[model samples]
Target: MTITTLNGVTLAYDDIAPPGGAQRTVLLLHGFASNRAEGWKRTGWYTAFERRGTRVIALDQRGHGESVKSHDPADYGRQNLAADALALLDHLGVGRCDVFGYSMGTRTAMQLALDAPDRVSNLVLGGVGGKLFDPPRPGAAEAMAQAMGTDDPETIENDFLKSFRHFADEQGEDRKALAASSAAVSPPLDRAALGRLPMPVLVVAGARDDLAGDPAELAAVFPYGKGKSLPGCDHFSAIPHGALKAAVLDFLDGIPDEDDFPPFE
Candidate 1:
């Protein structure tokens, strides 16, 4: 574990390379309520990447892992999260690289790619789908915030919110910090901006993931985007599924360096 201060927030991250050295790098952004270890390392991602001579850089986005926790809703905006990731890359002296994100991580990755396209080569989004384009459901954030803040779990009637609460408890997360982040409002995704991205993108999600909606519809919005559906998987199960890793590795293996192709017209 390494520590760096970006935007006045202390961030925790890991930088792992193969024995001989890394031929490439991939930044991993995990889902909300999950840290780098639980989301990537334990999921066999680190080992998989190491075998391929790819360096792995993963961060516990503020408030989730060993990183500094902030109970300020004003501090957890999606752009702010994305900025931290961008700053981490700059701090590491890494140039362009591939990016993979899951659920909330996908939001941050998309923001980073939009804000600094040249810094990202290939993009992989998992555990999310067409819901990416939808407006925030009214009161959903508030409900989640309430669920996290409440002392009694029984009060969380919504199964989705309850699941979040249960997961947070299991992870031993700071409920106050989670409450703040859950209540924060992120800027809506801009379809026009996404359509303009030139890098290859893969959107993968479980076919039963209602929270993500249809992966194909979301992929259609990108210039060079494709979608993959995992059978018998849902939002949670999809994260650790071997198929998810296989799909990501396959997609990444097929992409050449930026210099190998002409600018998209």
Candidate 2:
């Protein structure tokens, strides 16, 4: 575990070097309220990437894991988070590499690619799509915030929010910090940036992911993007699916055969 102070916030990250003769390097951005260890390590994503001969760098986003916590919404934003990712890459002397971001991390990864396409060789987005900018699911964010702030469990009051609350409790996270994290970085994105992006992009979503919006709509916006759906999975369930791994690994290897792609909607 290494820490870097970015504009007064301490961000924790891990860098794993591939054994002898690495093929490529990948930067991982985990989903909201989820840290690197839980999102990538415990989930077997870290080992999977390494097995593909790629060095891995995973970071605990500010307000999560060992990174600094902030109760102020002003402390977070899409561009700000994207800048943090770039600064980390700069700190590590990483010029070009592949980037994989899931759920909330997907927003940061897309911004990173748009902000500095030269720094990224390939971009992989999971568990997100065209609905990225849609406002939080009614009271979902509030439910999450409430969950993090309370130990009483009954205070969360919303059944859908239980998992998030449970997850925060299990991770021993700061409620206010995560609450702000969920509310911040949430202004609509610069949609124009997608068409202007220079690298090939891959958007993967679960077939049953209502929260992810339309993956096909997202891919259509990118000049060089493709969307794929994993059958029989929802947003969370989509992560560990073998089909998801196969699809992503295939994309990382090279452009997929046209047949594997979703028609632009």
Candidate 3:
């Protein structure tokens, strides 16, 4: 793990290469309250992409993992975090690469693509669905923050927050930091803005994942985006499943081709 200052905040990241090196790389961003390890390494995504001859780089977003933890809500937002991704790429002298994000990471990845369209060749967003296009409302983060702020997980009323409380406990995350992270002021993205993304994109979600919104509906917003659902999986269990891996690999391999697109009138 290497640490660097991005916009005056310390960020921890990992830049791992494949066996014979790779002509391309994928920058990965994990979901909220989660770090690179749980989202990528622990889920076997690191090995999956590496095996396909692509390098992997994952960052512990500001308040999560080993990155700088701040108690201020202003420090964590979509734009602020997106800048961190750009700084990391610049630090490594990377011009352009594929971006892969899961859950909350998908938002950050979207901002990255929008902010620096030239720096992104394509995007792979997982654990997300149609809800992204909807207005941002009070999400589970605040509830989860309060839930984790307390040591007793049994008191957590929300099933989603309860699962995260378990994960935070298992990973020994700093509860205070996570709580602050959850409280951070993150604004929702404009649905119309996504139409400006000038690259191909893939959105994957589990069939049973209500948290992901509607994958088919979400994919329809992007000019070249496609949606795929992993049958019989949910929000938490979707990424680590084999279906996600297969979907990602096939997309990168360009299996569908232009012929696969619905004919234009």
Candidate 4:
């Protein structure tokens, strides 16, 4: 674990190199309330990338993991979160690299690619899809915020929100910080901006992931984008699925045919 102060907040990250040094680099951004360990290492992502001889860098986003936590909603804006990633890259002296993001991290990855195109070579977005362009469901964010803020778990009526609250509690995260982040402002998705990205993009989601909508629709927005749906997986289950890792490895390696990949059991 490495500690760095960026934008007045301390951030925690891991930088692991392959046995014989790395031929390429990949940056990983985790999901909401998930740290690098829970999101990537524990999921076998670090080893997968290392086996490919790629340098792996994964960060715990602000208000999550070992990074400094803040209860101020103003501190959790989308742009600010993306900026922290950019600062980390600059601090590490990495010029360009591939990026993989899951769930909330996908939004940050998109912002980075849009704001710093030259720095990101390719992008892999998991657990997110066409819903990126949709306006926030009415009160969805508020419900999640409430769920995180409440002391009594039974009060959270929404199953989805309740699940998040339970996960936060299990992780022993700062609920107030999470609540602020949930309520933070997010940038409006711009299809025109996404279409302009020249680098290849991959979107992956579970077939049963209602939160992500259709992955193919989101992929169509990018000129060089492709989408893959995991069988019998939902948003959370899709994260650690072997098929998801295989798809990402194939995409990053520039494999032309996804059809040859075996179906997930």
Per-model CA lDDT versus the true structure: 0.91, 0.84, 0.86, 0.91
- Per residue, candidate 1 scores C-alpha lDDT tens digits across 1-265 of 8987877789999999899999999999999888899999988999999999999999999889888899999899999999999999999999899999999999999999999999999999999998877877888888888999999998888998899899989889899999898888777889999999999999999999999988878988999988888888899998888988888898899944333469899
How many residue pairs clash per model?
A: 0, 0, 2, 0
**What's the TM-score of every candidate structure?**
0.94, 0.91, 0.93, 0.96
Per-residue lDDT over 1-265 for candidate 2, one digit per residue giving the tens place of the 0 to 100 score? 8988965578999999878867899999998878999888888888898898998999998788998888987787878888888989988889999999999899899889988999989889999877876666677766666676776876666665677777777888777888898777455777887788988889999999888977778888888888888889888788878877888888999846567769999
Which regions of candidate 1 are displaced past 4 Å?
255-265
Give the residue spans of candidate 3 off by over 4 A.
136-141, 257-265
TM-score of 3: 0.93
Model 3: per-residue Cα lDDT over 1-265, one tens digit each:
8988877789999999998879689999998778999889989998898888889999999788999988776788889889999999999989999999999899899999888889998898998988876655566566767886886899988887888888888877877877887777766676788877878899999999988877878888889889888889999888799988888878877888443789999
Stretches off by above 4 angstroms in model 2 are: 135-140, 255-258, 261-265
**Could you tell me the TM-score of candidate 2?**
0.91
What local lDDT score does residue 20 receive in model 2, on the 0 to 100 scale?
85
Q: lDDT: which is higher, 1 or 3?
A: 1
Stretches of candidate 4 exceeding 4 Å from the true structure: 259-265
| Descending-TM-score candidate ranking | 4, 1, 3, 2
User: Higher-lDDT candidate among 3 and 4?
Assistant: 4
Residue 12 lDDT in candidate 3? 94
